[model samples]
Target chain A: MSASVPTTRLQATADAFLTRFAGIKASLPGDKSLRERAAATVRSKGLPGPREEAWRYTQLRPLTDVTFETPLHADVDAQALLGRLPEIAAPHLVFVDGRFRADLSTASSMVRTGAPSFGSGARPDFDPMVALNTMLAEDGVAISVPHDVDGGTIVLASLATGQNGRAIAFHPRHSVNLADGAKLTLIEIGLGDGVYFHNPVVTVSVAHGASLTHLRLQTESEQAFVLSTVYADVASDGTYDSFQLATGGRLARAEIHATLSGPNAIAHLNAAQLLAGSQHADFTTIVSHDAPNCASRQTVKTVLTGKSRGVFQGKIEVARAAQKTDGYQMNQALLLSPDAEMDSKPQLEIYADDVKCSHGATVGELDAEQLFYLRSRGVPEAEARAMLVRAFLDEALEAITHEAGRAAMETAIAHWWDRQA
Target chain B: MLEIKGLEASIGDKQILRGIDLVVPSGEVHAVMGPNGAGKSTLGYVLSGRAGYEATAGLATFNGADLLDIEPEERAALGLFLAFQYPVELPGVGNANFLRTALNALRRARGEAEMDAPGFLKLARAEMKRLSMPDDMLKRNVNVGFSGGEKKRNEVLQMAILRPKLAILDETDSGLDIDALRIVADGVNALRGPDFSALVITHYQRLLEYIVPDRVHVLVSGRIIRSGGPELALELEANGYAGMVADAA
Candidate 1:
């Protein structure tokens, strides 16, 4: 299970998987050059290794140990998967088993006009998953909000189905562009049942003076494996607020990389992870302040029960020239059972002279006195514990601005707690 | 309504209450005053079923039922409330929400319907107004950033909302100004009825002026030494527990 084995295995798997991409890659109706270049760059990079800072907390051994071919264009009924989540009303883009299903997706009339365009820039040397996704990923959903557009939200649902014994792997690529002065809320839900692996890469670009609030809900099955990456670039005077609620998946790791590339850019990253049984969840984030007068805040809260484990590692870096930068990070975890464990590391790397950077981490159990107080008030023992757990997670949930999105996340959390109970 | 006979309790093998006997009947306010380290708070905690106090030998009964075998919430459901001396500050839990939850929990336990949001709000507002507490206190986190008098007022607010049959005020009058003390006293006075009983644990007799007790007992070294009327509190306040301890010895 060494790191090099996964990298080498993934490289060979990618080479074999590229044969099935010939048809999908040739059918590029809009931009062939960008697709070809992206594919070439990905073939060269392969998959990411442990040396990469973004992939440090997560090990891809579980995903790469078994060679997986690009899943066929399987027949999937997304309506069956989406039981009651329609309450999150928005333009729905459904991707089943790594391929976009236009028939299962919502009506085109719900699609907003003036969609922002996406460009595939020069690929980097590292980040093999980004390269692999760029080279082999099928047609993904592109959502854009033009400059000054309002009153619209796009929901992207990626669902995977495992019908056979062979492990199914899906790489979903999404690019979101927010025009200057535009405001949009995006809700991305990664949900699947059965035993499968899903690797999703989402790129968000916020134009000058625009604001984008992204909510990622990861509630996959206990037998499923998920590795999600969110890459965001904030422009001058723009705001980016991202939140993640992870309560499912046997082993789920979410990486959020936000770069404040313009002056006066603001970024808020918050995540809440609730896991029980043998579930494992890792929330790793990196916030980079590249320009002056930028501000970033990150807070991660986790609650672990049974034999579950929670990991949170947050890093805030302020560049040398990023003067007057304000960055703060905090990660707190609560372990409910004796066998439960949590690991948290909050780090700050500040090279700017006039920057205010501070980070803190705490890992412990529920306060005994608080539990006693709640129990003394006639709340049942189990109900009191749940209330305390909910209160512990409320800090991160409060950071979500969208009322409907927050309510949806809370309901998901409650459902998970009910299952545990 | 409550009886403790031959009660002996300890913490980590060190007996705090060697042997205690007391009785608080219905429609009476009994004040237990003593010097520091006299186990005043321990008595209140033990009576209300707090943990960490091992009852080596005790026989406590409340309304003809054995109280020692019940859990804290069960005791609370049976109409027992202990106003903490140092009320814990629960961050992120709103004061209004906590009170409503506690009240509704008790109600449901007693086979009563839960209070609606509007009804709960109206009752909370009236109680807050009666206590002279600011309206904003209801919206803030429970006891977080609250001053001493504010915490005391919060306890009184809970008393008003829950309306337990037996209220144990463990040093409730310690950190309060005269005006705040009068408000708390008025809250307790309003709840006074033929079926209600209270055990007030305090040091000074100053609070007795507002909420006079029918009987005052002097607890020295975990045992009640003397019992008399309200005049006993005044006498102890003037002479202090030193003379009383010497006389008992």
Candidate 2:
């Protein structure tokens, strides 16, 4: 178990147990060459480990203990498992069991094919997950927006069915490039049931003056395992806002790496994790301010109950040239049961004196006065507690602007509370 | 409407309310004027069934039902309301939503029809106007970032909406300005009726002038030492609780 070893015994076991994706990677109709290149890159470089600062808080021991394989192309009626995802009405790219299903995917008139432009060749040195995803991902959905395009949304859904016996790994790559002055809303939902594993990676690049809203909803089953990574790059004057709602899986980790590469660019990263029973969820993020005047804000909230555990590690770095950069980070956790535990670390590495940077972490229980007030108002004790918990969580959910997507997350939270009750 | 016989309560090991006896009939307002640490707030909290107030001894009955064994929410459903002296501010819970939820909970407990949204809005609007609370308070989180007067007014607003049979005003007048005090008193007076009984806990007699309690009792050293008509409040105001407690001693 050397730190630099790329492939673990578990990953080898997983590879041996499952079948590779059999879809026609060439006939995907959008950026076929780019998909092949990214897949080749990820295959060359395997998963990163604790040596990588971004993956420090979350240990991959649990994932490496079990042998997983590329999931077989199994029959999973998405309608039967999810019971009709509230009609998204926008362009949708659906992947079931790691393979794209064209019949199930509906692309809007706005979806068009074009050469991937943002960061196509300009590669950063530090992020290993990006390299791993680029090298190993078999195929992905590529969405291109023409310069100055505005007001359209794209959704990518990776769904899994537990009927497969062995552990499964899925690398659903997504390359979204926003042209100058173009605005887009992108939502990625990773959902599954039964016993399985999912490794999903999405990369987004915003052009100069472009604005993008990216949201992720991870609500897999308690028996499932997931490791997801999102990479974002913002150009000059571009704005990127991303929110993640993680409330499922036996062991789940969401890693986000964002780079403000241009002056005056802004990024808002927010996430909320609700864990109960023996569940474990982690949100690890890093924001690198490489350009002067760029700004970044990150906030994460975790609520742990039963014997569950949660981890949040956020790092914000301001380079010497990133003068006047404003960076803020806050992580708060609420432990409802004594057995529950939460670990939060907020880090700031600054190389510039003129930059404004601050970080905070808080872990505690539900406010007793708030609880008493709710219960005294006649709400049942359980419902009152749930309402307060929902309120505590609303600060994070409010960041998701998509009506359908936000509603889905809310439903997931409500269902979790109901199950606890 | 409410009766307490030899009520004994403690917090941890220290007894706060020892052998407390009180009775409030329908349509009556009883003002308990006490010196600092006289267990005035303790009595209010004990009646409302707040946790941490261990009732080691005594019987409390509200509307002919045993109150000690019930939970705080059950007490609220039984028409017992405690207007907190320092109301807790809830950041995301809207004031109107809190009121509506509380009202519906009490309604459901009493087998009454729940107030629809429109009806609730109308009632809330009228109550806010009566208390001079801005309509915007409905949109704000419950007492969050509110000034002292606004928090007190919010409590009075709850009293108006819940219409509890036994309303305990716990130091509701402590931090209010003259204008806010008048508004709060007006809200309480508006809720006064033959079916409503109130226990006003205050240090000074200033608020009593506005609501005009029917009786005033002097509470000192966790015991009521003197009982008299409304005039007793003015006397206590003129002489202060020190003189009254010294005279009683």
Candidate 3:
């Protein structure tokens, strides 16, 4: 039935998007020829329809209804914006409405960048959102860490602020390249005010023996929409560890595509979404082991309360040549209310005979025995439930190896819980 | 400190505690001994307010407060503690964290200031040493991988920290070696005082040799058929439950 539904939805919204594309296609950054060509690709493909396997869970009807305008560059007070995430004190870069606010960014001596696209080389056939970002991304940071050094923490804070009641959107293309034997920690915090769409495409390339700890804190405004796309490539013996905390946004989807392109490379993706009210948060991840002896682990946890909905779709693909590949994916959800809902789709596609791959999905309410155990110890019902919920999510956050990043993520989770009460 | 009058309860359609009349005044220890299928565990579950236990007819009171009318948490705030035969294993919850949270919650109910982290850790460490538990147990998940003896000891540790006015140890002696049993009895004996009372429920007389309850009651079916002094435990140990159960029948 959804086969025809996506086509209808796409046709209804294609005109609006095409018109918007025409206005910004010429002005988009990058080589003029590349920008125009990306726009043409977007126009030809149109937006992702509901029938598309990935776009099935997330509908675009509400998004199409909004009269989204191009977000013009507006100078912001970086100090005030920085205060929101005062716990993170590192060399930082600030972006407001997809434009870099230089006055607010701290200079880093290790890495440099030209533009950001959640890079486009991976799978161009499916994600029209990537095409959309490729056609409209204004400016993104280019970063590369030096080899054999402990590159401290780099805070990339994206703030979306707009006025005049204009429903606006911005796409920031961010690219990161870590050289062989290099090490770095990147904390990407996305926060905003007012009604807007913060669609960002990020590309990451990790070289031999290098390690990248990427932490994403998406606390967009309740009225805002966020479609974040991330594409990562890990080389021989490299490790890519990422954790995303999705606690904000009306409709938030974090789509990550990771490829272990070299032997002995590792990709660990962990995410936790604490959603309430009418909010919708979805975490979709696809990890492909294209090299022999590669390992990948993805664990996602979600806590839904009130009338919120949470969706998780995780797929592990082991190629024919990827022998001895070890892949594991688990998605767990805890529903706190009768009205709250969750959808989990865990898939394993393995063509290699010697590979080890497994996937698991579980949805449950608070354990009555655990709750009674806590309550019988004098904790009230609410606090006991909150403790269990936090503990449930903490299990997934344990995948974060970097001490500082893990602590920062824990602090963010605490804040989210505090606001929940 | 504890009182139960005609306490009748059941799980689903099956009746368990037919009619139990028991009371332990301040500064006393009472032991309820019964054979299997005597509703010993059901009594524990009903008193702890575990769901699925229906109290059809009962009147239970703790420190002059009607326990049956209040929630399990409120009963806890009144200093009622139940040491389980099988403790829960909270996978991601640290033992230290659970203890501090429970302690702080009790303190909050009494409008007292919360314990600081360092202060809590210090107290917990001391208690661990007193119970012959390793300090690393604090770092592990709450009873996640703990052995049977370790779980019961952890419960005793919690009871030691919470310092309740009335504690109900339900078959805590089950699956414990003589050494573990001695340590557990010592843990409970340390908490005994003029104000602290406990009802130690067991199926064997071995535990009584160490804890030395002031009174021993033999339960048959769903009723306590006999109650006697500490010497009665030795009598039951020598004669066994076959005689007492046959006499009750």
What's the distance in Å from true for residue A35, model 3? 2.7
Per-residue lDDT tens digits for candidate 2, residues A44-108, read 44345565565666666566666656557655677664454545767777777777777777855
Tens-digit per-residue lDDT, B112-219, candidate 1: 999998999999999999889999999998889999999999998998999988899999999899998998899998888988899999988988999999999999
User: DockQ for each of the predicted structures, in order?
Assistant: 0.63, 0.65, 0.81
As a TM-score, model 1 comes out at 0.93
Number of backbone-clashing residue pairs for each candidate, in the order shown: 1, 12, 9
Top candidate, metric DockQ: 3
Error of 2 at B52 (Å): 0.8
Candidate maximizing TM-score: 3
Give the alpha carbon lDDT tens digit for every residue of A242-265 in model 1: 999998788898878899999999
2 or 3: which has the higher lDDT? 3
Q: In model 1, where do residues sit more than 4 Å from their true spots?
A: A1-56, A64-69, A107-124, A164-166
The positional error of residue A217 in candidate 1, measured at the CA in angstroms, is: 1.2
Clashes in predicted model 2: 12
Scored on chain A only, each candidate's TM-score is 0.89, 0.86, 0.94
How well does each candidate superpose onto the true structure, as a TM-score?
0.93, 0.92, 0.95
Model 3 chain B poorest ten-residue lDDT run = B46-55
Off by over 4 Å in 3: A1-6, A76-81, A110-125, A162-164, B239-242
lDDT of 2: 0.80
DockQ ranking, high to low: 3, 2, 1
